[model samples]
Target: MKIDARSTARTLAEIGKWRGVLLYGDDLGLIRERAAQCVRQIADSLDDPFRVALLDQEQHGRVEEEVGALSLIGGRRVVWVRDAQDALLPRVTSALAIDSDTVLVIEAPGLASRAKLRSALEAHPKIASIGCYPEEGRTLIASLSDLFRDASVAVDREALFWLSSVLGADRAAVRSEVEKLVLYAGEGGKLSLDDVQDCIGDSANATLDDATTAAMAGDRAVADIALERALADGLSPIALARACLSLMTRLQRVLDWMDEGKSRQEAIKLLKPPVFFKKMDSFTKALERWDGAGLRRACEAVQGFELACKQTGCPDLALSRRLIAQLCLGPRSFLR
Candidate 1:
């Protein structure tokens, strides 16, 4: 049967009752997490030699054999298949027919809706199918709030908003960062906006963001410092170039909104993946300094930097520096 999102938690906790489960989704992190929970439900340690049998695509042919075999330790066993593909459908379908207590947990990242394996699992009487997609917007905010609440940490609404806005494109990264916040807060600690920033906001992405924002605002010194700090943090030059390109692309969209007779605030609000609340003011200031034509020129210049950074043996750092210099001086300073 297909597990509803509302019942995923309850179902996961009672996973031992199911013969097999197909954990498939765009969020590989969530898929891995759910698979781990299932593994723990049936076996003591994730690495329990006798009870846990790990499998991959190459070894998937042995899934049915593994699922049918009893644990030498005299308890339930778990068969974990990682990075599963549709070709394993027949084996999984056949394995579900076994009357053993062992449970099968399959992790299939980026599984298609109509994929044979997915369809078979969802329709099977003894199997549960769960889709693990990334959380966003209010869902993301609520999850973050619950995570903090469960840890007995009191986080305010504004702090939650800031976190949801900047946390992740994947559940694993969000979980890792949340663990850091929990540790930083200690027992019964209250998390303020400053606390969250100090713990979760000190990331390489933040430094890159600082560089792009300062570069756009013509603060050459701050831009250079942030760029150097990001590089020191081990972010690749190609990553830095891409960050600049992404910001310029967003600014161009903001200009498009403004040209449509929208006010500056309205245009900024229209930006998808909305600007980080703390950086809103600086982003606004930078947007105000550019018109449509100039913003378009800046976007094209940043694109060129991105392309150059991708070339083999390119002096990516120097090219990135020159691009930032011109961006700080506005688009007319582009090198021929």
Candidate 2:
């Protein structure tokens, strides 16, 4: 049966009933977290590599062969096929029919509503199809409430708003930060707005936002400080670079929309993955200072830096720093 996001807890609670699970979603982060949950249900330790067998694109096609091979050990086994596609349905169906102690998990990108694989999984007696979509608006609020309820924690009303404002659609991040908050509060303690701010606030988002805004506005000192803070927080050079590129892409799209006669608010509304309400104004201001030319230069710089990181003997960190510095200090004449 197909599982909804709200039913995630209930499904997790009764996961043992299903023999095979197919987790596919738009949110790669949530898909991964659910896959891990399934693995943890069967695995004692991730350190034991044998506990789970991970199959990539090439190996995933051989599912029937892999499952048909006898396992010397009678213990339960989990075969996880990553980046799953429709091509594996036949083998996956065969694997599920073996009536063995093995569970097959297929993780893929978003599947169509009438997809054959998804429909087959839903109709199959022993398999559970899980949809891992990002929570938004009311769904997000409900999910948050469910999480806190499960965590046995009480959250203040204002605290909920603040926490939600800072959080994106990353379920694992939300759970991790909440777990931290729960640990900090101890038993029977209530979570306040201050607690949310101090424990669950999104420092990473702030750092990236600051760095991107500063860079776009040509504020060298602020950009330098924000980039430094990000590095200190263990953000990888490549990841930081991607963050910059991603922001540029968003701003450029908004600019494109505005050039086509859409207003700032309308352009913001047109954004895919819709900007958080709290960050709408920030993005609008960014749209003002961000233009196509700056975006092209930044993209080239980010691409070159990524290539350098991939090639051995390249100073990845230094190259990353230089890219950010140049974007902030160069003669781009930011539209602001």
Candidate 3:
């Protein structure tokens, strides 16, 4: 059966009842984390030699043998296969038919939605197929807010917004950063935007943010300098293009909300992964300069920019700079 994200913890607690589980998604960190949780559910320790059998891409052929083997310690066993692929489907099917007490946990972090292995697992009555996609939008914001609340850390709303916008897509990385922030803050400590920035922000992301903000606000010199620094710091042209598209997407969303009768301030505030407070003035300026139709065109162009960056022998850096310049000059100039 397929497992919903919300019910994953509840389902994981009873994972032993399933013959096997297939964990797959874009979030490798989440897949690894959930796979560990499944192993812990069945064993005393992760490295327990007697109760847990660890297999990798090359050792997946041992899955059937491991799943059917009796635990020497007289408890249920767990056979974990990492980076699993469709080639192991037959072995997994054989293991499933063994009627053994052991549970097979397959970790395929990048499995396709319609892959035979994923489809088989999802359709099986005795197996669970759980996707570990990255959380975004309000769900991510809420999750980060809960993390801070649970840590007894008082974070300013804008600080939370910045953190979520920047790091919330990677579950493991965000959690690690949040732990660092919590330690930096100490128990019951308060975190302002500056505090969080000092604790968790890196130069590369900060440079990218500066570039996007400056470009949107029509500050070409600052945008060019920041973009140069970002590229010099080893950030890819594709990443820069994506960053611009993301900012434009957010701005377009705010415009959509305004069209729905919300005030501009209300619409901006309603943005998930809210705009950084420090960038509010520049963000507002960009908003004033672009309406729904212009933003729509800008978004389409930025997407094309990203595609161009991916082509072989394309002048990625030049295209990236040109895209930024065009954005700074406004859609009217580029559309011409």
Candidate 4:
């Protein structure tokens, strides 16, 4: 029998004591998680405890030999084969055929619908297969919400939208960020946009925003603070330099487009991934502070820093600090 990922929880709970199971998915995390659950289920069903073996690609042949040789201690034996590929499938199939009280659990990357392995597993009355995939649409949003709820944190709609937009590419990263947000918020607290900005926000991008905001308003103090924070975060000199260059480049482009009678929205649309609405104010301010010439000079300085990083044996943290100090002082400060 083949089961869908969403139905896995209930299916595991109700699964009969089958002789074998094959759990496969593209996502390794989900595959391992489900496999653990299945092992627990088998343990619960058996009167006497069973032995569990984890076989990887390299260990599959040896494990298959062991499976063929071993008998149930007092109950069923469970063997878990992970990272199963085409080369190991035949051995696994042969091992599964042995008429013993042993159960084989197999995990693989993925399988085609018409593949021989799929056909064999489907034909076997004693085998069950489960599929896991990346979550989508409502499932994705719901999972995010559940993470917040589990952490006892209340996530507003706007906050969820912001998070989903920024961190949705990797589910694991999203979960980590949500956990961080929850921890930052503490008990019985609501997560606000400011909290997100303060805790889990992209520091490099945040630094750029702060610097751009201050520079546009001609506030040297704020720009200096942002530069200092970026330095303290251990960003390499070359990385910081590149980021500064990119920020200035973007500001220049936005300014040029706006000057050509383009609306802010139109400029944003032309930008890849479209700038987040919250970042528009910072971009507007940055454009006011630096002209095309100044932005070009900043890019040039970034190239110089890249050379320094390559040539010097100095520790990366120290080099980064020195670079930020120089940038904070002014373009001329880089000369010293």
Per-candidate clashes, comma-separated: 0, 0, 0, 0
Best by TM-score: 3
| Two-way lDDT contest, 1 vs 4, winner | 1
List lDDT for all candidates, in order.
0.79, 0.69, 0.81, 0.61
TM-score of each: 0.67, 0.57, 0.75, 0.51
Model 2 scores worst on lDDT over the 10 consecutive residues at 327-336
- Candidate 1, lDDT over the whole model: 0.79
Q: Write the per-residue lDDT of candidate 2 for residues 93-194, one digit (tens) a residue.
A: 788777676677778855656678888888887787888865544566677777787778889876776565455455665677778888987767789888
* Tens digit of per-residue lDDT, candidate 4, span 142-260: 77888888778897776765564344223444556677888888878898766777786564343434553444445567666765675564333544554456556666777689889
Indicate which candidate wins on lDDT.
3
Across 1-336, the per-residue lDDT of candidate 1 in tens digits comes to 999999998999999888989998767777888899899988967999899999987899998899899888799999999988789988887887777888999999867788898888898877889989767666777788878888898997777877865554367767878889999999799989888887775663445667878888788998898778766755455455555666777888888888889998898888766777777876887787766677777777777776676556888888878877888887567534
**Candidates ranked, most accurate by lDDT first:** 3, 1, 2, 4
Model 3, 1-336: lDDT tens digits are: 998978887888889888878898767767887888899988967999999999989898898889889988699899999988778889898888897989888999767777889998899999888988666567777778878898999999878777766662446766777899999999999999889888775642545667877888888997888788777755566556656777888988898899899999999988766677778898999998887778778878888886776566999888888988988998696573
> Per TM-score, what order, best first?
3, 1, 2, 4
Model 2 lDDT, residue 141, Cα: 68
Error of 2 at 189 (Å): 4.2
Once fitted onto the true fold, the runs of candidate 4 whose alpha carbons sit more than 4 angstroms away are: 40-50, 65-77, 99-103, 150-153, 185-190, 203-336
